[model samples]
Target: MSAVPAMPAVRVAEGPVRIALVGSPNSGKTTLFNALTGSSARVGNYAGVTVERREGVLTGSHGGVRILDLPGTYALDGETPDEHVVHEVLHGAVPGEPIPDALLVVADATTLRRSLALVHEALALGRPALVVLTMIDEVKARHGRLDPLALSRHLGVQVVGVVGHRGVGLDVLRGFLDDARNWRVARVPTGIADAGARFAWVDRVVHEIGADVLAADTRSDKIDRLLLHPVAGVVVFAAVMVLLFQSIFAWAVPAMDAIDTLFALAADGVRATLPESWLVGLLADGVIAGVGSVVIFLPQILILFTFLHLLQDVGYMARAAFVVDRVMGRVGLQGRSFVPLLSCFACAVPGIMATRTIASPRERLATILVAPFMTCSARLPVYTLLIAAFVPATSVGPVGLQGLVMLGLYVLGATVALTAAKILNSTLLRGRVSVFYMELPPYRWPTMRMLVRQVGQSARAFLRRAGTIILAASVVLWVLLHVPQAAPIAGATPAETARANLEASVAGRLGHAIEPVIAPLGFDWKVGVGLVASLAAREVIVSTLAQIYAVSEGESFRGVLEAIQADIDPRTGRPVFTLPVALALMVFFVFALQCTSTIAVMARETGGWRWPAFAFTSMLLLAWLGSFITYRLARFLA
Candidate 1:
């Protein structure tokens, strides 16, 4: 190792000194970023990728310091989009962003040898650099010894050890940051040619500053014995997921009912105070019904996120990924693809963005193309509504029939995604399979603060979408259903008049035009209109249905469900929403790429129209086929 000349001091004139936190995936970088800046950036146990760059202001005795949490990457050589972003940001190539004044390279103490390559790369950047060793407690628990002072002396840089989740050694770490002048820029040996040479140098440093003969972590190993046991591990994972989905239904019912009651009361108050007019109808049916229908699912979304964060915090996500790697590998994806696929349950937009962490371009593209099949939260409202209306709520042994049906839908999505990945990898996106490597962090109790923060962030995002996109779609649908009204029939109720107007309006004509195409799948013209409207967002289907039905019956969510159950077909004189039709609708939602936001994100991520267009066409075809088969089978059985 050679020592480079010390660079001249650079000082900020007034504002906070900008610092960048960079590290490999699963190296505790996010935890340290959260600890230092009080930011609630998402953290996961698996090799999760952050798509967006987050910035926070850290305050201390030295005053406010700006901290930017860059996406985690294994190298600075720009192999992945995340790596490219970090490379650009550090070089001041990112538009509208200045070069960071200093760099903090976070490394996992348990895997320091593998982590050192990136640390070496960061040091080569010639910026004021410091190394923060996170998860030191895990190292000690495994009887590993690390002397930070010795490492600092050997490397010619400041070194600090901290347990980020527990907030240990943070004060000492803060003290080092408060005095920025003492920070050193690392000198790299000029002749080092390749990764092998880099690893050789890292080996020498580790031998000199880190202890040999570190004991194994028996506790983690023992837990892994069961959690990673091929059959047992998979069983446990299945059980955990089943419980999670079951709770989403069972636990959210009260909160959802409360929201429904509140909205119903508000609508009643409006109708009572105002005379029958277009304004009253618009407010009660368009705004209240549309927005409230989507908002009622908020409880389920929050509950789902809470469970996800808890699993991530407790460190089981990595083990779960490991257990599924073999199955994923057979489909040309590594274990890293699991997290992003799982994220699709929340929304495909983020799920597609999470592919940046995947190193293999082919694998990443395959993951993105199939992610929409993962049954996102937006589809939950439709699923719940159909399940409640048709599926019996009887308990099948230990589980509710409705919960089992919900779980089956999720499993069906996963099955299709894996199959699609296999087909794509074998044909359009075929490439060499990449090896999977992951570190399992020790399990710890999740902090309430962290859990609360994550839940709050997810809830706010869901509400914001409902407020903007869904609200707009609702108003548009309302106008489409109300315009070009025919003269009112004498001796008819307001509900009858509204129905008559809807049948004569533009929306009705469009729906009827498409009804012939979807008739084979057991959907009516009204449901066809919803299918068209849901392109903006999957949850918009719920709001669209609510608006259309509310204008006629002026009913609450439960009442609407009952009304749909009793709806008679004009030709067959049977209930419109039979068991077969409801089941077919659920199957259609399970496979459809109905969310336009997802399509837009896919376009942006893939950097063109081709992939997104392919995704939309393929998924839409599959949805129609799947719904047709399901409807046929269900109708035969019924």
Candidate 2:
């Protein structure tokens, strides 16, 4: 019953030899790929699709060979964009990609019976093949049976068993891969396309080899009973989220202060080394102070991403999604929509793109329209700045009041998003939702290496943005606030003179022009300036305000909180940013469509400017109304 053994090696294409890595989700394919090509991987979007393309050079002196990791798909016949792309890639139909020289079909050892059907599909492609069995350690620990020799014999492909996290069997896999000149195409059987025959072949192989894995692990089952409980699960998730926010404030304070101190010294050093002039002012007040203010929030950002990655790696995120699916249905969204919204907390561009998984256009459109309401990482800088300056640090029971405010803002965004989706479902995008399905991955211990790598990537991305967009905006804002310098008053101090110059300059004039409209929300000209500048990017406001305060204060950077708190209004003879004003500012940011990149992506996803325009119009009005209510209510209560 076995297929024929390998023939002589076929010649690969002239340039770099490409191997396509294919698998179903939770099959340990990502872990295997990461082990095979640690830091050399490159990630980008495919030519015409937003699906992420990840490829990397093979390790162990395999000079020019590249391994491309395709999106995880259960079957080639599925309707999802991921499945379509996989089929296109296999047939060399994609524009920018060539047909792969070989196919590496990865399978979870514990789920081999379910994976054999995918292997059959791969063999039908008539490409050179190497089958990898991941989670082999788990199989052995469960006292299950596996015979790689017999499985390869039946399938007519080379087979290797590996424990990806422990780096077991990797050397052998690499050596086999290094012999690319010797790779042989797998033998394809007759009637391979028949679904019944394909599945029957899988069943026979399992029965003959006794390869069915042990029933789901006892330990995982025991844990799932508690975490998957309808009632207890939500309570535990809520508690975990509260602690995550609390740690962001309590854990990051030392690092944020250190960064602030370092930048202050750097700015002061530049001012002392060079004589006082426009150049010195630009370097000290604009570039250093502006960039430093946003960069100081890096510690908090790192903490946030760490919690996210840890939860994902430990296999808890899927459980959370499962728990939320019930609530999602009440809002008329499919269970598949939960993953995209969950991703929105990181950024909306990818979240909107993820809607391709929903086969129903109406459901997908509704998810896209409301995706911006999720509190993204870009909003963290604004929220942290206002909360630290205005919210007291007193502990409310076990949680700090600052942490409570952060959590409330996040909850507010999500609550509004669901409400909006419910309305959209009932009106503009009315339709029946498709059937929903999700797999809960088994719990595993998170590796420190993966966690560190992910956090490092996040930190680098944040720093890159600071060096580019924020840096440019800071310089421009400096010029607008400094040009046409005011004549020094008779008895004015240096700070007073600088403050007066800023009020008379271009930026100050622009802020004042819009100040009348925002006055009802308790904002002054400086906040007006920040709000206008933030439209470019949500985090830009943090830098904008830092530059405004730096020149107005005419002193070294003494932490953004201290500088913002020191501002006193000449007309009112009182502090500018009181509790009401600060709370209003936070509420405004929660609803604003402040990032242009998000708008552009929305246009791309919706296939025109119409939906993006509508979303912007609605959110803008909501932000203003939300801010007004918050400001007036807070003032009245005070």
Candidate 3:
């Protein structure tokens, strides 16, 4: 282990002053950071959703105060990765990170007792310290009295109370931040190195100020009575998820329709204005049709992100995790696994990263292995495309048939993941389930500013994927589908000639080579090609299908799917993409380990390719088996 760096004396810096915000999780530190620096915060490194550190500048007339929002840590000891990062940041041991000149201790006014334990640890670092009491509005609502003057006098550190989200008392906080040079030094209490004594000092300070939890938490408690009930909570979560899926299809129609029409017109204009050539075909068919099919689902992605952010901001997510802890017990896991799996709904990469919080290595490894089975945003385009084509939009009571299908797909994914973890735990990765302890945050109305910022970030990330990975893949597939063009037959009609050309292309041959392997799942050569192409990214399948089905699009929106539904296979004497095939396709997507990035991340997390290889092989076999069963069942019903 490296020697700990000596503490530096507080002095004015040549550059902007740096202040690190240290607090326990859900103490309103993030809200305070947002209040201090709105929309100016930037995340570094891999740009994945599993970010731990953020930096922002509090711009004021006096100067720019750079604020470092470290990962929320319960204590200074490095038991977990988050806490380790906190320890490193404070000690100036993190490479490429400068030592912070001061520390801002943020504590929730409703839960200050345990929070002060963290404060005791932070002040021991000997940096200039400021304690900001967040959620002061809730503190007042409960009729709880807090004397900052008294508290500040006791700790020998300045204290300020502010409702971070509401902008209350920000002026006083800003005034203190502006005069960074003359900030008061925190005096660490003597002979209090022991844990009991440290907290005793904390208790003395709290008692002197009469700071204690009052009755306002009951509002959250009352709401949680139903939201956290063993039976009722699960039901409510299911209903909320169903509504969320319904909104994905219902709320996105107008925007999707507009995008569809715009892309269709653009394609038509390109063909008409530009001369008939391979370049025009490349632009109109390859670029417009291929990319537009996937882009039309952007509205649905935005809606999903909005709902996710809303639930997270409202603090219901923790309750949901708590509710699921029971189910985790039966599966030989714990609520800690559920939190990472919940994150998997966004992306498995982050979900896998979140398993770092799990102390048990075997349990953490199990969580990482099964995380990819959770339905992610990348699967949305594929799911929506097939559901929209096969499932009717008619409502069953208050829910649409399409939405119920979407919800079923999500539930199926999660159910299978849990089952997989159970089997793994019983067999190869068997281990004892670890204890899970989590703090439930008080419910509050989400601010529109924070909502917009979060959704905007997710939206930007989606567009980036569309532009980079999807764009390159589409171009590559287009080249494969169009290369080595066939000569026109003397008596062939345009449709016949186009079909012949497509069949003779490189992609066509490649698909045919794998047709025998996938035929039992009711997929044709074109779908085989799509399955292969989508390995780059799941949404790439929709674009691949768009390019593959560009033969006869009338309006270029739903008309494309209508044409697809109308397609016939001469060999089978049936519609190419029938209901059974669509169902089978969705099932296949639900289980297939097709993402290379996921594979890479899994390898990195597991310390080798051994586990990733095992996961990929197992999931691929399961995908085939699941698809075969769904196809046979649908065919029998038909």
> lDDT: which candidate is best?
2
* Candidate 3 residue pairs in clash (backbone atoms < 3 Å): none
lDDT of candidates 1 onward, in order: 0.78, 0.80, 0.78
Best by TM-score: 1
Worst 10 residues of 1 by lDDT: 41-50
Model 1 earns a TM-score of 0.81
The C-alpha stretches of model 1 lying farther than 4 A from their native spots are: 1-15, 40-50, 60-64, 178-182, 273-277, 336-365, 374-414, 431-435, 519-527, 533-587, 595-614, 625-638
Clashing pairs in 1: none
Ranking by TM-score: 1, 2, 3
1-638 per-residue lDDT for model 3 (tens digits): 35755434423455788899999888889888888877778765312213347888885633468899988777898455556678977999877788888899988877877788888889877888898988888878888888888878877889999998889999999999876556777876755667788788888888878986477578888998888777888899778766765676678789988998999899999999998998998888777866775577678767777876787789876676677667787887776676677767766655675575564456687889999899977798788888888887799999899999999999999999999988998999754334346778888889898899878876775576566655666677667777768888998766556657766788778889989999999998989878877775687676556556654445333655776788899877878988899999999999998876577668767767899999999999999999999999999999
TM-score of each: 0.81, 0.80, 0.79
| Candidate 2 wrongly placed segments (more than 4 Å) | 1-12, 190-197, 230-232, 332-411, 421-435, 483-492, 515-526, 534-586, 595-618, 628-638
In the range 1-638, model 2's lDDT, one tens digit per residue, is: 25755432334445677889999877888888888888888876676454567899887655577899998877877665566788899999999798888888999888887888887788777788889999888887778889898888877889999988889999989987776545667775756657788888888888888886576687788888999777888898777756765676688789988998999899999999999999999999789977886687678768767876787788886786677767788998876677677667766655675576554456677888899999977798889888888899999999999999999999999999999999988987765334456777778999999899877866775577678766777787678878878878998767667767777788778889999989999998899878877775687677667656744443323456787788899998999999899999999998988866567667766667888899998998899999999999999999
lDDT of 1 by residue, 439-543 (tens): 677777889987887678767766876787667776776677677786889997766666677667777678789999999999999898778767766776765
